[model samples]
Target: MRIPLIAGNWKMNGSLALIEDFGNAFSRTSFLSNAIDIAVIPPFLYLANADEAFEGTPVQIGAQTLYGEASGAFTGAVSASMLKEFGVHYVLVGHSERRTLFKEDDAAILAQARAAIDEGIVPILCVGETLEERDENRFDDVVLGQLDAVMKGLSEEQRRQLVVAYEPVWAIGTGRTATPEQAQEVHASLRARLRHYDENLADNMRLLYGGSMKPANAQELLSQADIDGGLIGGASLKPDDFIAICHAAG
Candidate 1:
């Protein structure tokens, strides 16, 4: 049985004051016992503070991004090892924004995934197709290509330690969400691809649906068989909504 994981990706958001308030509110909530695993990925600067803030709680802290190198003079990069030092257990890699804005290709994302695994940090690898590709009926090929690049140098064990987030590029932050069936179809396809790589790993791995996920539609999305959890965006910023999503997972 796969445990549900509801993760918040606070992309380029939150201040120390906001983090403090969020933390306080989170601590006061009555989360279901081990029903769902809740994680928050804040900006790199606030990780240590978030970790301290969520102390003694089941809420885990994650990083929005991390460099492939463990320690380097790369000037402005936070490595996986450095993130581990700050108690980060998960790292978001290959987000759609990073792909479109920073031009991060599969090779770079794969390297980051490998580095995160080496340092024992779970990498939430993002893969999806753009609206044009979907319209062209080449969505499968696009998503598969992205996953193939990352799976190239990884072993079955390493792959199992990683999580995959399928955020349809066109839907992310666009106020449009893939219908529950649409999201499940893509998720099932992803799981089938993983099964082709390793059956055991595929069965145990958690696949999250990102892109405009919120409390309102969370129950419908979470009810799908292959949809293990979510890689939440805008709705994650609020304490009540995020907590509601977690409860929906239950």
Candidate 2:
């Protein structure tokens, strides 16, 4: 069975002091079991500190984003190799914010995923549809298009290191959430599409349901067959809520 993973996308939030506090809070909490995997993707500036804070704990440290290239003259870009040097275990790619705010295309996201995997960091690739697409009944097309781009040029082995996150654009940080059934439907469809690419790969890949995943609704969402865990947003900032979601996964 694919192990359940609860990942917190800290986005652009948190400072060094706050990260230490968050790490302290996380370390004190008792996990449901070793069956669950927990990760936190803090801002790039805080990665080194977060990595040191989480040392020897079950919680894995990750970076919110990474440059597609290993290293270069890109003034502001953080390369995948650099993240790995800081002991980062996961990287978020194709996040809605990146796609919307920075106009990141699928090809760019694909390159970032490749770089992360090449550097031994797992990529938590985000794929989702907008409110307009959902209203027009074109959600599936949008999601599949995003997935196809990343899947392209990826070998079977490379694909296995990925964790796909379904975070409907309308739901992320909007205080809205896809119902349990709605999330399961899309997650199931995503898995079915993966099966067409490679059955064994599809079966092993972990599909997480993101978008306002909180303590109140985590249990219901986690109980769904296709919904593995969550890529939490606001709730993850709080230790209690994040831990609650992790326990729900168990």
Candidate 3:
């Protein structure tokens, strides 16, 4: 069975003090079982501080974005190797914010994923459909299309070392959420597609729900046969809420 993973995407949010506070609160949390894994995706600037704060804890540190190339004149770009030096074990690739705001296409996202994999980091590949695509009945086409773009390039071995998050663009940060059934359908579809590549790989890959998951809906969502955990946004900003979701999962 795949271990459930609950990851928080700070997404241009939080500061050193916030990290400190979160670290303290998380350290105080005693109910989170070993049955699930947890991660915090903070902005690159706070990675070191986060690593320091969460050191010796089970919670993993992750980055919100990263560059494909290892080293270059790319002044502000961070490389996977650099992230590894800071004890980062996971990174977010193809997140909706990166896809929509920064115009990171599938190819570019794949490059980042490969970079993370090369550095022994787990790139939590974010794949989902936009409001337009969902309303127009192209959810599967758009989502699967994005998945296929990268799946072909990754070998079976590489495929086995990955995680996926399905964040419906329409539901993210809009106070709206995909119903349990709605989210399950896309998650199952993703697993089915991966199964075609390699069943064992597909089963090993943890699928996370990223469309505004919170304590309120975490249990129902986690209860889904295909749904494993969450890629939390707003709720993750608070340690209480984040751990509550983890509690729901545990």
Where in model 3 is the C-alpha error above 4 Å? 31-33, 173-176
Candidate 1 per-residue lDDT, tens place, 1-250, comes to: 9999999999988999878887898788877667889899999989989999998778999998878777868998889989999999999999988999988888889889999999999999999988888889997689988887898679867988889999998775566668999999999999998888889888999999996889889999999999999999998898889888988997
After superposition on all C-alphas, the RMSD of every candidate to the true structure, in Å, is 1.2, 1.4, 1.3
Clashes of each: 0, 0, 0
Better of 2 and 3 by lDDT: 3
Ranking by lDDT: 3, 1, 2
Per-model TM values vs. the true structure: 0.96, 0.96, 0.96
Q: Measured by TM-score, how close is model 2 to the native structure?
A: 0.96
Off by over 4 Å in 2: 173-176
Cα lDDT, model 2, residue 181: 93
Candidate 3, residue 12: lDDT? 83
Every candidate's lDDT: 0.89, 0.88, 0.89
lDDT against true structure, model 2: 0.88
Sliding window of 10 residues with minimal summed lDDT for model 2:
170-179
